[model samples]
Target chain A: MARCRALVRPALVEAVGRLHPWTGEMAAYALGWADPAGTPDPTGSEGKGVRQALALLGAEAVGADGAEAVPGAVAVELVHTFSLLHDDIMDADALRRQRPAVWKEYGTGPAVLAGDALLAQAVAVLAEAPGRHTGAAVRRLCGTLNDLVSGQAEDLRFEDRPWHGPGAVSPDQYRSMAEHKTGALLGCALALGAVLGGAPDRTVTALDRAGRHLGLAFQAVDDVLGIWGDPAVTGKPVHADLRRGKKTYPVLVALAGGGEVAHELVTLLSSGRPVDGEAAELVAALVEEAGGRAATRDEARRHLDAARRVLRETPLEPTAARRLDALFAHLLDRTW
Target chain B: MARCRALVRPALVEAVGRLHPWTGEMAAYALGWADPAGTPDPTGSEGKGVRQALALLGAEAVGADGAEAVPGAVAVELVHTFSLLHDDIMDADALRRQRPAVWKEYGTGPAVLAGDALLAQAVAVLAEAPGRHTGAAVRRLCGTLNDLVSGQAEDLRFEDRPWHGPGAVSPDQYRSMAEHKTGALLGCALALGAVLGGAPDRTVTALDRAGRHLGLAFQAVDDVLGIWGDPAVTGKPVHADLRRGKKTYPVLVALAGGGEVAHELVTLLSSGRPVDGEAAELVAALVEEAGGRAATRDEARRHLDAARRVLRETPLEPTAARRLDALFAHLLDRTW
Candidate 1:
């Protein structure tokens, strides 16, 4: 992961710098490479570079040098950051990575414009890529963007639906939204790298499938952490998702379980009063008693197992395949 | 103009419809092709289709059938609508074309997302154009987007600067912003059409220059209309620009003139009191008395003449050159 980040980070920075200077500066701040005044911040916290690593690994698995996939890696990262910027605005998140969010630091208008510019820059980067598969890569990237927008739209719409009634969002609906929101981009990262590396269509498709499953597992794990993880490590308040009345995986499972405890939980959450720490603790205990936590963990393991099976069947180079296996295991082995 | 609109509008509608359905519906409504419920409205209000006309005329000037440039025309129109959608949000304007703005009709979140989807769809449309120069076309389109964002940023920043101090935006600064915000996309429309029609590099460059001049003239005329045009015809409030304290071309010209009338106008505008009908009339009289209005009108004429000269010098078929001359004259001959 460190080696992949070392290869892709500079290229990503350079690509962002190529934007219009004002927009470039805003993007740099949003990406944690610079302070609000455009000064570089060497120690700024950054994301895990998971998508970049996936792109490079996907290329390497298909017998191409990882460096050749730098453009794809950079483009995906830009798109990811763009999503984060807009998502923070829509979700009204005040903090990110233990600092004020972009919309909070800069104004909302600038943050919105910065995110739009970043999306355009990402497409521009791919459109100008010196690769034989540039056209195919752009098409795939646009499709992924469409999926991301659809997923976000659905997520917003879901928030307005009744939490426990005929109009409630089903588990299937949640899964579909998750697939579009997270899985599509992850799949596109692998597919883009595979296409750039001259992989056959079948191999590219398999890689995309593996990536989708990996993304699902990753989101499932994140949902678990949202409920039960330590705030000291997670950088989020305990029962943060519950206090916000978010219909996360375990909460949804408990709601669907349909018992006295589930009914009480729904009434308590829907009452619109603040869920204090004690109430949050009681809800968490009820979710555990209903087997919601264990069921959610099982779902994550199922997807991770499916991802590993796909990797085992795919005809990747032996070293690349082993690295991918290790990476998936590391991603899924986070605390329950 | 009618012929060009006839050729491009359907393709434009089709391209927008190809976006994700929810986003597509919002975009359709924003483009005035549909209502909020996703039903088609054949008589819906539409823009003047100036950019679409430039694209088709550019192709015809290069001896290609206008239909061959339909994709370019549609792409440019999509980009144009995308800008309007975002600009309305940034400007906080509640009305567009005498109707409620997209952000007012739909919520801000959907409006922003729809605008974003439109931009991505525009690039996707260009990337899939069945032309040998599709790659170059997409690159040029992306560059134009960058310029547009920069122009918007400058426009917003200028609003925050002191109108009477050293930080005041100059006439030259206003011209640069107009060129980027308006001219860049118009030039790109012509350039994309020319490239798609297989025009030689020299012809493509000449067409781009003509389009830029035309765009500058268009914006100059628009500035005039913003202050003095008939509300019934223009579909905007009388003295709309002055009411908003916008740093339009004529306003900047007046500020730089440094006369008693200009200074009084500045004081009235900077006071931040609502510019009611009587106050707007006074400001308008002051602007005209200071020669700002006449100077702005002359600026429009200058660009119109420059665009005409470019058309005369470029080697086009005699018939096509005559058509281009008439088109430019018609565009600039709107009621003052």
Candidate 2:
């Protein structure tokens, strides 16, 4: 992951430099080049580097040097930054990566422009990539954007629905939204990496499929961690998703099966009573009692197992395939 | 123009449908397909159709059927809409095309998403175009976006600079900004159209060059109308730009000469006193007396003539060339 991130940083930095000076500074901050006070960070590192690692690993899997996929890595990361900036505004999120959100720090208008600048640069980087399949690559990335829009819209719609009963979001609906929202981007990264690595269409498609499985696994783990993970690891308060009344996977699973604990859980949640930290703990216990925690873990393992199987089945460079398997396992067991 | 707009509308509508329903609805309203209350417009006709016309006309100029450029035309138009939606948010403008601006009507968050939707669709349309030069075409549009970022950045920077001082925006800087802010889109329209229509590289470049000249002329005329054009025709209050302390072309020219009238105008402007309608009118008179109006007109005329000469010199379909000439002349004389 560090090696792949190292490969991505210089290219990412140069692409961001193309922005207007003020926006460049803001983009730098959002990407962790600068702090909230506009002071440049010496480390200049930001983000989980998941997509960048996936892209490089994907290229390596296809028997190409990871460096060959830099354009894809850079493009996807820029797009990722663009989406996060806009999403933070839409979500009214005050903090990102332990600092004020771009919109909160730079004002909404400039944040919007800064996001736009990153998105435009994303297109430029991919479109200008020196490859026979550059056009196809850009189109693939754009199709991911389409899925992103759909997922975000569906997520927003879910917010308006009741947490339980008639208008509740089904487990199927939640999964589909997660696939579109988060899965599509991970798939895009792998697919773009393979294509840029000169893999055949089938290879690219298979990698994309594996990536989507990982994406689902990733989200499922996050859902579990949101309720029960250590705050030191997740960087969020305990039961943060529950406190916000978020319709996460565990909660949905817990509610879908009707029993005494499920009934009590729904009542406590739907009571509209203020939920303090102790109440949140009780809700978590109730969900776990309803088999929510176990079910969510099983779902995550199911996806991770399926993704690992795909990696084994698909034709890939031997060493890279082993590394990818290990990487997927590491991600599944991620403490942070 | 109507024919070109007709060709674009169906495809444009279809492309917008690809977005999430919420964003799609907002985008429809932005493109004049829906009313503010979410009622769909019966006609579905919207926007100035200038970019669409330029694109199709560019194809005709390159000896191809205008239909060949539909993707390019639609792409550029989407980009134009994207820029306007974001610009309204940045400028905090309340009205657009005789209605509440998208940001004003839908709130900035949804507006930003809507704008982002259009831009992503713009890239998708061009990237998916069926042509040998699809990559180049998308690159051109993305490069135009780069120019747009630079232009908007400069425009915002100009706002922060003193009206008259060491950091004052010069006419040259203003022209450069206008070219990036506005001209880049026009050039992209023509270049993409010609490229997709199978024009040679030289022909595409020439058309892009001519389109940029028209862009400069377009901004110069808009600057003129911002101060002196009849508000009844322009749909703005008299001297609206002056009242807002905009450092427009005419004002820059007026102040550059440092004459007595210029002195009075600067004194009036720098007093930090609120400029009501009467004061704005006084400022306008002083600008006119200082030759600002004449100089601006001459600047516009110079660009128009240069564009006309380029059109004449370039190899193009004769009848299409004549029509383009007439179109350019009409634009130069537009009342709004």
DockQ of each: 0.65, 0.73
The prediction achieving the highest lDDT against the true structure is 2
Q: What tens-digit string does per-residue lDDT give for candidate 2 at A1-336?
A: 988888889998889887888888889899888886668887634787889888888999999989889999999898889989988998788888778899999888889899999999998998888868787789899999888777777887787788778899988999999998888999899999999899999999999988889999999999999999998878778898888888899999999998888889889988998655899999999899898899988889998998899999999999999998998898888762
In the range B60-128, model 1's lDDT, one tens digit per residue, is 889988877888898899999999988888889899877788989987777888888888888888888
What stretches of model 2 exceed 4 Å from their correct place? A36-39, A43-45, A259-274, B42-45
Query: Residue by residue across B1-336, what tens digits does model 2's lDDT show?
Result: 887888888989889888888888888888888886778876544777999999999999999998889999999989898999999998888888778899889888788888888899989988888868787788889889999988888887787787676787888999999999988898889888899888999999999988899999999899889998898888777887887788889999888888788778878988999776788888888899999999988888999898889899999999888988988898888763
Give Cα-based local distance difference scores for all models.
Answer: 0.85, 0.87
Clashing pairs in 1: none
